[model samples]
Target: MAEHPAYPVGLRLTGRRVVVLGGGQVAQRRLPALIAAGADIILVSPEVTPSVQAMADAGEITWHQRPYEEGDLADAWYALIATGDTEANTRASAEAERNRVWCVRSDDADEATAWTPATGHSEGVTVAVLTTDARGRDPRHTAAIRDAVVEGLRDGTLVAPHHRTRTPGVALVGGGPGDPDLITVRGRRLLAEADVVIADRLGPRDLLAELPPHVEVIDAAKIPYGRFMAQEAINNALIEHAKQGKSVVRLKGGDPYVFGRGMEELQALAEVGIPCTVVPGISSSISVPSAAGIPVTHRGVAHEFTVVSGHVAPDDERSLVDWPALARLTGTLVILMGVDKIGKIAEALVAHGKPADTPVALVQEGTTAAQRRVDATLATVAETVRTEDVKPPAVIVIGEVVKVGPTATAPRE
Candidate 1:
């Protein structure tokens, strides 16, 4: 036998018979890729791992529930010999060779007619890598290479200009909390593909620095009570850039729909017949509390949790929140954009029958390096904010659930 370089080729096994001679870990791993390829999979084994049996139960594959036979490869376009039984695997491999079918042996790669390459997919591109040498094979090294290539492609570090197919549209991507790594994969990929990114000050700011130099980065910072970009103007920017045949990504902090005015932008885009993609993000309402070791709902403590915007005072005519109704409920209340009105909000809750001694936590800049938690009673929360010098972009958690987590023992301000 001569050692030679292996020729790599993709198999179009859709609707073709693929016989798997085992039901153990190896079969468990290979069955998914086979099923994903639309292959008609047949598993011949008396016993199978729970995961492999699940595939049979789901009708994803046919289970023979018996040992492999000589004629098992009669109609198989491909065979995977991974029963882990020396005699059985050898017998199956010989049968596959006799039938002139491509076979992969889990126990002996040298005897296998085909090898599975380390594979990955990114942006509609499939990468397959195989390292073959006289010194033998290194599957782990091959997989590492595959991962590096896929990650580089995803983060816009390694440019494959010829593979790009630009599509002009508006993507309302939720940047997720305040961490760059927390953004959704689709959102990050769209950001990499963006020609113009209209970013909010709240989202993963670090990600913007990674964008290609050719990309246009616009500051749409909506600072509270400060210089901000108007909502209408932001919408116009999206419409104008998209109309000019450019991909526009409106990156927002937290979830776009959660008090982020994402719907306003979407509706504005819709009016002009511009296509829009809404990628939901992790809202600060819940994530911020969690980051500070506070569970919004704890067993036997809070059965329901409500998220409210505190941007408007309860006494304001523009306010829509039912502060009285909220006070009546026994569940946890998570407040966003309420730092400025914490005193008024605390007063309203107490006046509406909510206990003045109800536990309160303000997690500032949650999930970021500057994150800090301040504790106080509902009655003292206003003074606590003033004394602690808490600022905007903090999540105010109210109710007994705040006292149920690790932050329960935190010193009150």
Candidate 2:
């Protein structure tokens, strides 16, 4: 018999019975999609993989916990025959055929009534690819095609302006430490969809270059104690652009909630009744230290890690951090925005209880090509920063975990 071209159509199986003949790897892969389709799934197998068992435990599916019966396909809108038992799968496939239920056979697609396509989703659109030839089908090739289409849609390389629905609002996107690739997929997609991007100086700077010429890029860099854009002005700018019917993205370095003053921006937008979407990014507090080969927490070295903002001096009334309490802790202490006040911070820590010789490391411009690590003890960190001319936008790590990694043995600048 000559092979005929398969007609492709999506099945609406919500609240309908779908029989799964196996509980092994093949069933494990197919069940989630079935559940997602809102199918009332039935699994007939004596045993199942741990992950499949988890789904059953979670009340996501019904488990028969027995061998396939002759009438297992009864009332099933669709069937998947993936039992490792050859005879059982063949029998199940025959039952599906007699009942006219579309079946997918894991062992033999040629004999099955239906073939699952390689499917992907991007921004409310689903991309499904199926390829067949005289010899057989290439599942991997089909998946690759599906991936390419989905990626293109996600990054704005493929655009159907007529098909897309544009909503004017603000998205608080965290661009991650510094690398453009480090940005989250959702954050990058929002950037691709944005009409106006108000960005910080620290996050993924290179991503701005990739934007189309129509995109308006605003420099909202709030450099500490330098030429800066005021917070009030930035808030007004977001409100102004969004009111003009444009999609605005406030892209900040690291996670927005982590000392990024993201809440203030959100509250300001909330007062005017403009909706905002927050996409979290990898915080530099933990990532910067890791990039420089320092683990904030280590087994038998440090049990806990505390992240503190050192923008204010320990002696300053505006400072909220308890220097005495922090100095007494045995775990790692990661400080941000402390370059200018490192001397006072060091003095307060030592004067309270922290040993002067505690190991410390500062990772400057972390996760970028210009990344560098400076090492010193608590006693000498102030003078070290002075002699080394260390700048802002660096993570300062204090504790024994700094001395645990391989960088501890490496030469210091």
Candidate 3:
């Protein structure tokens, strides 16, 4: 009779010896999950990637610093054969079989006794996918399913829990750069469980519509600037709502501390003895330019990138930024909230000795379906902005890196 299929089980490998008989890319990819599972990993390899070496330096894993030997799997409960050599992997698997230990061979999964499932975690729940057929398991199929499940969890389409305890508290969740998919798993989970969502104009607005009907959605901009409620009033609103035992989520765009005034709100909440939690989001300064296919710091094009707020013009008395210093640097300059002041900003940079022809890219509504890019130079960006009618909430990238992309050419009118 044919043998039964491989039993799928979640191994409780905490503090257990898990021998990894390689230190190549496969091992590098699998080590993180092994570490997360609390396994005492012993990596046997003559050389490892810098990341694996760093992990060893940090005491997260032990490196044998040599090729696989006959007794490598002696005490190992599990083994991973990922060496570049197929023969080495086969020998390691044989040793694991001799020791009655299951072995996962990255080089030839079908020849091994175990397979690593595509895995993801959300809000304390771990999802693992393993696809097996007459031939063997398909990693691509398993990973696709895993990604779909995690995507559903992040977007709230996958129903887990609508109500977590209604304990009075505040969670400062960074909603990531515009894309709802980019938000952290913790941030998304908290958003689903919030009793009141105080949201920003630039955050993941699509997520607000997904909240349960019972969850109150507060437009932060309307609550304060639109309705004449000051920052103090907004803070009071949080304190008052939480005092009534409601969970308040301050969902802001990008990272809360990246010129988002998240600390100001945190301080306000602290003065009233309200406990707050901050979940960092992906900053647009970096992600936005990336979405437009612009690298803020490229290997030889640019070495450093500076992120600054452009709400105030460089010539304004209230402006705190040193325009001359910024102009002197031959690096990338990322400006947020600067569309309105583009004319004056560009002039100041050029006047301050930034190359008049320095390339600039304006990414509007970056990382979203409506994202658009307008390219120009420091000398012509003002006219380009006018020509394109680029609005606020756009990221302005300035530097030589802008001219290094595949399609980058002379500035367009």
Candidate 4:
């Protein structure tokens, strides 16, 4: 059994100058979290994404448009080094120590001064597991066992936001690709014990059915590519729910942190002295591809996979997608929310480098009985989907694996 983090050092990072040395989605994901924790964040990265620039422009954070400088760590209470580049992250972690500031290395948790546990929170209690250990599963064995246990709990117990606090926890549950059953068992248990469930409107409803008849279910669901929920509003709700001394389960579709605005909520909960933990769910970005018999990473056919939302922005002006290069790439491309952009996305792929006959499949409601896969190609996918009336909440996968029909059952070994 892994030893629990003794004394569980929970530091208050509020109002502290925290320098984050990477400003892409990883940092964007981390920034809202730190800000919610009340950190006066200074983001330093040579390159920044539109999200980072927007956050910087909004005065939600301070931006330093250069690589990490030795002086950047000065006076900073804490430092997070999450640059996707491994070398830069290592150097930043080292630099933070030279400045005598506490540091957390985002790329390598074990290398940090304090490793952030994969958390499960509700009520007032946060269960930080270095890794959940149900006795004996050595390393690799342990991880699988922990995941199984966690998944089982999500699907079975973590649904209700109950009045319990002593064993308080929050399930950062992945509602699972719009399919309720895809949610893990541990997620269900957390829901069952919830006193408040702050959920995305698009998350699966069947999963919510697991909650006891009277459990409080709060719908914080955001409309698709529409009037996005003000982050502050959702933040306030999480704190308010947890402050009620009730277990709040943020039942989001897919993994809460994976494009689910979960980090924002967690930071808010942390600021108010309410512990926050996450229960991860399968991201449809890849899950949908898998359910449709597409291996995101197939040996020679495709070695890399990129998942970008086709709905990051409704109009095409500021969206930064290199359709030309993406079309020619020999890797799987999975897109979410491109029902409207399906025609354009497919055309772009064909116009660039993909074969007109390249296999494309649209898997809707993956991992559930209602799951449906519509197979086509770069040339015909758009029209095929349109004619079939496939709707949003569908994941589009383009790769050779689609031709394999991965949905077929495997023969017993």
Give one digit per residue, the lDDT tens place, for model 4 in 1-413: 13543235666988889888888876876676677778899998988889889989999899988887667788988888877778877777787777778787776765666544444443434444543332432345534655555554545543333364365545567777776667665676666667778778667787666667767777775422235557777777777767677777888888887778788777777777788778788898887777767688877677898887797432378778877778778888888878778888877777776788877788777777778877777788768886888887788888776765546332111
Residue 9 in candidate 4, Cα distance off native in Å: 32
The lDDT per prediction is: 0.90, 0.90, 0.88, 0.72
lDDT of 1 by residue, 309-338 (tens): 999999999999999999999999999999
lDDT, candidate 3, 326-413, per-residue tens: 9999889999999999889989988888888888999999999999888999888988888889997899999988888775656875
> Local error of candidate 1 at 157, Å?
1.9
Best by TM-score: 2
TM-score of each: 0.93, 0.94, 0.78, 0.56
Best by lDDT: 2
lDDT of 2 at 188: 89
User: Which lDDT tens digits does candidate 2 get at residues 259-299?
Assistant: 99899999999999999999999999998899899999999
Tell how far residue 286 is off in model 4, in angstroms.
Answer: 2.5
lDDT of 4 at 161: 36
Model 4 residue-pair collision total: 43
Candidate number with the higher TM-score (1 or 3): 1
Task: Supply the global lDDT for candidate 1.
Answer: 0.90
TM-score of 2: 0.94
**Sort by lDDT, top down from the best:** 2, 1, 3, 4
